[model samples]
Target: MTFEMLFVFGLLAVTIALFISDRLRMDLVALMVVAVLAVSGIISPTQAVSGFGDPVIIMIAALFVVGEALFRTGVAATAGNWLLRVGDGSETRLLLFLLPVVALLSAFMSSTGAVALLIPVVLSMARKSGLQASRLLMPLAFAALIGGMLTLIGTPPNIIVSGQLRAAGFEAFGFFDFTAIGAVILFLGVLYLVFIARFLLPQSAIRETGNPHPTLSVFTERYPTAKQLHKLIIQPGSPLNGQTLSEAAVRSQYELTVFAVQRQGQFLSTLQPVLSQTRMQALDTLILYGRDEDVHNFCQALQLRRLGFPETEMMKLQQRFGLAEILLPPDSPLTNHTLKEGRFRENYNLSVIGVRRQGLALDTRFIDTRLAAGDTLLLAGAWEYIRALESKRELVVLETPAELQEIPVHAGKAHMALSIMLAMLMSMTLGWLPNLSAILLAALAMILTGCVTLSEAYRSLNATSLVLIAGMLPLALAMESSGALSFVVDYLIREYGNLSPILLCAGLFLMTSVLSQFISNTATTVLVAPVALMTAQTLGLNPEPFMMSVAIAASTAFATPIASPVNTLVLAPGNYRFADFAKVGIPLQILALAVTLALVPWLFPF
Candidate 1:
């Protein structure tokens, strides 16, 4: 091997080791790879940061926002509610409806985002159906992986593989090219999970085993001082107009706590001590919690314009307002910050009325209390805004309030959101524009139509995933630049070129599947795809089946918690150990292998 080749191999080893260690953040690890490569001179400084500029990276980032818009507007949850209606309280029945719906959604959007939207819904289902979350999450995750194979834009791997084919001078695969085989695998996957796999899945101690907490009602009952919820808009003439919340002594003097404050059409919260300095201004909306009499007296004494909350408003909280319980994830940025410092309400457009730790409501008066992993928060806001919370890495929505009935977050925007998404998909499938342009237009439409806000569109981007893909891209370049990729391809063809095409395809499937379990699967596809194309050219065989195998194998990230972001998203909330994934995922891997070996050649033979 050349010295450059050796250096790249050593870098890969260290990167894999750090990823497995789980000590440092994955994005930091990716940056470490980018730095070492740039310093080593294997690739130029420009190449080191090239992944950031890659269309694949940008497309992935834009898709995150689009998927978040769907969730925020309640488009995703509408699918979950379909499952609940058909489930009828049976784990088998729920899985029957759940896996397919999740898979279909994954076919269009980011699978990780799909799982994030469904996690809370599934948890609520677990509570209602007396099933463990462990029973549901793995199936949800695996189905999403399979779903990625359903469309050209479903996951990064599909896009990378198509890009690779084009780079190799072949017509890129069609948008639904993957569907024929993907549909069968999806059906088989659902059957396996529903009938067999759910039994094998773990029942972690973290999951509420017996009766689950009454999610939203508990929040309402536990907030000691907030028996009644009221809204008041501060006008310019109000006596407290010039004073900060603390100086105004609204809580002590009025016996009411400001749950949330909205200013200039943007909602703000006083969770941070810094917010105590947020002076009362005219036209600020205050959501106050207290006894009816105390709130009435306070409003009268202060001459604040008390806005009567319509009974209809409270009745349709999901449509007008939303309630949900969120759990902080391990090693999250929000873990150590108090609500005030974190500006939870300001960032999320939600109100924090209660916090639960160790199954008991802590003192809500301590707005500065530091959040911890597994800390439960009861938040209320516009259902659309509450839906946006799922996109936040720091907070995992655990359960939708049963009281809200999972109200659609977008009132008029659902049709618009769905229409924009379909148009984006049609454009890609029909070749009206390049995938990147189509995605940019769709994402921009999501914002222009009020499906999501500017900050939200940006927040929707998963920086870690984007960075990881970008950092790893240079390694793919290095593989070809240093002759490492060609070396491996030559060796494989020399050994297996004469084998039946199916066996060769099977070998490719195993290798790609295993590699994806340890690294970013998109990166795996970027690396393997060129080699697959090269091998096909050398063997004088059709490349489609071989390329399809790589695409499918790249997505078999089921066997490890660290395998895919989707799995990582579920690991914490499911309270899973690494072995839990292995025990279930390994078997599914075998099944997927069998399916690929049986089907790929049949669909696209040499």
Candidate 2:
């Protein structure tokens, strides 16, 4: 190796040392590597910074938005819930369903996206099932890696290897060509993780899923609204059926607040907001909050039938409406006036459900009780209206229920989000659009269609992962440009060429897998694929087995968290140490190698 090559190798050594030490952040180390290469004249500044704009970085970032949309729209939660029901509290059963499903999804989409979408899901599942996150997360990352081996578009390395074959005047790999070995690997991988790996994983302190903020039950108990809130169905010929909420003025007539209306349709029912011009129809169920006597009097006078407002129905209503604790400022104009006297519902469109004075919840009628400057009011309204209260200078939003975060803003638009995601998936699978283009369109569609808001999309990105991936890409470029990669590959093949072809394949697999642990697997494949092809040709053997081995080995990036983005994504959530991966991953790596060695030659014999 020349001086520059030696220098590049030294820089790489330091970088790896930093990564393994965990003393500095991974992204910072990657940035330092880029800066060193540029300062050392190893690479031009333009090339050094090009990684930030690489298609890989852009694609991963876009995938974050799509994953976030899936999350915010409840798609991931829906899948997680289904898996939970199928698993039925069995860890092995959960793994049986989880591993293959994630792998299959990874086969069709970006592995990073698949992992990102499911990390939260898996965490939620683990929390619910009483399993260690570490036990389940590493397997998730590994299965996603295996998933890339399932389809041509599953990962970049697969596509690169196929293109390499096509360029060599051989038929390109069919879409499902990788699926044969991949399915076997997935099956064996599931068995390994379920039986062996679980014993090896750390029993980390579980991240609590329970929110600290007060729940709906807490609000209901404090306000004593369970017995007070009632649902009334408007009967035929009721005078209130054809009148709008503004015209009916139930609050004015009976002192009961019409919080919302549940309208039943032929196929489905909808929760309608009680707006000024919202006209009630016959058979409409009205969600009301007031004293029992007042509610009974209103129902009796209006010829309405009272229905039991069960806790489950209240929870469902909580999704459409929000509950918040508001404190009246001392200088507030409405501080001395009662809720009804202040026209609270008409002026603010929020009904005061309960009042707490000096830390004591009032047991008496709060609507007619004069409000105090320091009194706390429990308000209920649509989420939008509840959110609007935050801007008022006269009142302080002391607390909002934690359930609001769990509620999807686009819950009603779940089907639309699902359709968009399916369309994106189909476009990618059928090659109707390029992967990056399809991802961008899908992310944009999510925002445009309000499946996820712009702020939510922005919050979805993992800055560390994006920076880490972008930063390391340049190091790969430097390795390829500086001849370090070729120098090592050449030396290895030159020394080992006279050996048996099987041994040669083994060596190639080992080299590719080790290199993939530190650099981009796509770069690893680009460099080693040619060597594999040339070695087979030199030995007068068919190149298919060697080429296939190289591709398979490139995906065995399980030995390090930095080996693949999938691995990196799970590093923190799994609370894994460097040795944790080596302990479990090294064995899995060896297993994959054994499987590839035993199968590739048999499947594509010379």
Candidate 3:
């Protein structure tokens, strides 16, 4: 080997060692690779840093925002709800629904995004169905990996391989070109996860170091007033119509708290926070919390009709409003004063629905009761107002309901977000715009339409993953520039070229899949794709099947947590150990190899 080749190999060994040690973060290790390569003069410094500006890197970053907008607008959660309905609390049935849905989503969006969005959903499904999260999370991750094979934009590796084909003076693989084989793999994968792999997954309970987040049931049980929620609509001739909440004096006159108002929209109803200046309109649905007697009297006195607050309505309330516990500090200015006397509603824009003293519920009219130090108050209001309380010095936020984390922030814009995504997909499919352009446009649309805020879009970008990808791209360039990639390709051909074409394809898949278990699959494909193409040309066989095998193998990152972001995402939540992945992943990898060898040649002539 040339001196430069040896140097590159040494650097790679150290990088892989650091990755395995988990001493430094993956992105930092990647940066180290870039620095070493730039300093070694294998590639120009400008080339070493050029990967940061690659279209693939930018597209991946943009994909994060697009996926996050889908999450924020409740588009992804709606799919989760569909799973809930289809699964109906059966573990076997849930897996059947969860795997395919996640895979199909992964085909269009980022696999990491699909898995991240559904992690909480699967956790919820587990909680509701009395199933272990481990049984579902591993399959979810695997399905996401397989889903990447469904579309060219599904994962970075697909794009990398397609770009490689284009760079070699060939027409790039079209959208849905991968669907035929990917669909077969996903089908066989779902069946394996449901039957064979299901038994292999560990059943460990979710790990918790401290107190877990309180659920809605826990709060409703502790604070009975929460169960007294009711919905009332004002009649046309009602006294409340056209009157501001301040003028209505809802708390004092009717002994009821208007948490929010359900206003009718052009096509749907929207929940608006009940601010002091919010005017009451005829037919406005008032969401109230109070005694049953008060709700009945208020409806009768105001000529309003009462509506049932069913479980679905309560779920909507949970999504639109925030319920949390706050403790009054000893130095709080409002201490020793009743809520009404302290003007709590006027100052904080939240309603104190229940009070607990010394761990006992005070079974009195909480509005008239004086606050005390160390007393916990159950506050109900819009999420924005509740979040505002975080900066208040007088009160300490004790806990928030778990539903708060799962609530969709931009549910009203779901249609807009979905439309943007569809347009982007159609543009890519019809060749109206480049894949990167479509992704960037969709991401920008997400922010412009308020599906996700600018800050949220920035926050949604996974810096570790992005940096890792950017940093590694330079190393691939260094390997190719330094003749290391050529050396490896030549060595493989000398030993494996004489083997049958089918066997040669199988070997390539094995090598790529094994490497993917330790490094980012995108990087794996970057290094292996050139070798596959070169080997195919050298052997006078078609390069298409070889490239397809490489792409499929890169996504077989199921055997280790570090193999793919999707796998690591489920590690802690599933309470899984290292062995948990291999128990199921290794077999899946072998099965994928078998499928690739059997199908790639049939689809793409060798």
Candidate topping TM-score: 2
lDDT of 1: 0.74
lDDT of 2 by residue, 342-439 (tens): 77777777777788888888864565688989998888778878878878888898888766666666777788888988898898888999988988
What are the TM-scores, per candidate, against the unseen true structure? 0.61, 0.82, 0.79
Model 2, C-alpha of 135: deviation from truth (Å)? 7.0
Give the winner by TM-score: 1 or 2: 2
Better of 1 and 3 by TM-score: 3
Worst 10 residues of 1 by lDDT: 267-276
- Which sections of candidate 1 miss by over 4 Å? 89-91, 105-138, 148-180, 199-202, 205-214, 219-412, 498-501, 516-548, 560-583, 600-606
**TM-score for model 3?**
0.79
Model 2: residues with Cα > 4 Å off, grouped in runs: 68-98, 116-140, 169-172, 191-258, 266-269, 275-281, 287-319, 334-337, 357-360, 364-369, 406-420, 444-460, 494-504, 569-584
- State residue 489's C-alpha deviation in candidate 2, in Å: 2.6
Clashes of each: 2, 0, 0
**Tens digit of lDDT per residue, candidate 3, span 209-299?**
7877887678888988888888888889998899986687778777787888877552113687788778998988888888988888888
lDDT of 1 by residue, 65-150 (tens): 77777766766555545565688668899988888888997887668656765775686566545567778888899999999989
Q: Per-model C-alpha lDDT, please?
A: 0.74, 0.82, 0.82
RMSD of each: 12.2, 4.6, 4.9
